[model samples]
Target: MLQKIIFIFLLVILVSCGQETQPKPYGELRLEYPKPHYKLFNSNSPFTFEYSDYAEITPAKKKDWYNLSYKKMKANVFITYFPIHNDFNLHLKEAEKMVYEHTIKASAIDTQSFSYPNHNVFGNFYQLQGQTASNIQFFVTDSTKHFVTANLYFNSRPKPDSLAPAIAYIKKDLEHMISTFKWK
Candidate 1:
């Protein structure tokens, strides 16, 4: 009976391990972001991030975006910086339009919505969802006399309930880029 039990346990393990599924490595992601116009330089200011050395930042030539990639994590992080006056409503509207247009062209956004402006960032984040809602996250920023827009894309479905943690992780890197972002 002991031998039979061992055999059954081994069979169960084999069956379970054979299943095909998406691999999500916690605290790590895989993406291919476009490059920024300029190389990022170190700053003494608090607005800097401690990125892993394995990561590379490059400017995206095909599109108007900056791509940051992590070799170790196999993730793509893209950022676009738009410069504008903060107090101008017209500029804000224009920025919003640019972000929406970009999103519409990039993904299948069946439903589009915007959130209240984040006072801290002096901008807002918009969410786009289709049948599966976990594929994209969009943001617009008009901070420090600069209009910055960003989009995070994933091959996986981006339902907030399921992809929230990964989205959160991506945002951390995006935030770092935004904070250190400068136009040359």
Candidate 2:
């Protein structure tokens, strides 16, 4: 009787082991952003520009400093203003140094110069590609009296692949702000 029971159990196990297997499919996450609406940002500071309504603007510790915080994206654009007391070269050097400091982690750095003669708004925009802490940096000046620098930072680990969409969206807003910038 014991030998017969063991044979029956072995047969049941062999019958259950012959099923087919299926492979799991791969997938990617999709992110969508709202159409941007901008409003003119004017303050007691010496400059004015258009900023995205999606972001909240708050005063920084410094007198003329401000932060454009994007809560949904977990990022901020920090902007600082200074009076160029015949130290334009020094300011430019400092801005350039700040941007290049990320070279250790940045795969590539591309720069584009913007000139708005009518508004006296001229600047250099730096875009850093790769897993860098700050992907964007810029400085806009009238070359004699006013100097302004801005940098973009995300509040998370640097992962270029995952952050591409948010970076591109914010970059568009930054470009628009630069184009519409004016010195007051």
Off by over 4 Å in 2: 1-22
- Tens-place lDDT digits, model 1, residues 1-184: 9999999999999988965898986774544444323345453322222343445766676334556665443456565554454565666666466545645434444333332243334445554544332234445443455454555555554445555555555555555544544333
Return the clash pairs for model 2, or none.
none
Q: Judged by lDDT against the true structure, how good is candidate 1?
A: 0.50
Per-residue lDDT for 1-184 in model 2, tens only? 9999999999999998886877878888898989999999999999999999999999999999999999999999999999999899999999999999999999999999999999999999999999999999999999999999999999999999999999999999999999999988
**TM-score per model over all chains:** 0.42, 0.88
Q: What is the lDDT of residue 126 in candidate 2?
A: 98
Error of 2 at 46 (Å): 0.7
Positional deviation of 123 in candidate 1, in angstroms?
Answer: 2.1
- The CA lDDT of each predicted structure is 0.50, 0.96
TM for candidate 2 is 0.88
Q: How far is candidate 1 from the true structure (C-alpha RMSD, Å)?
A: 11.1
Number of clashes found in candidate 1: 22
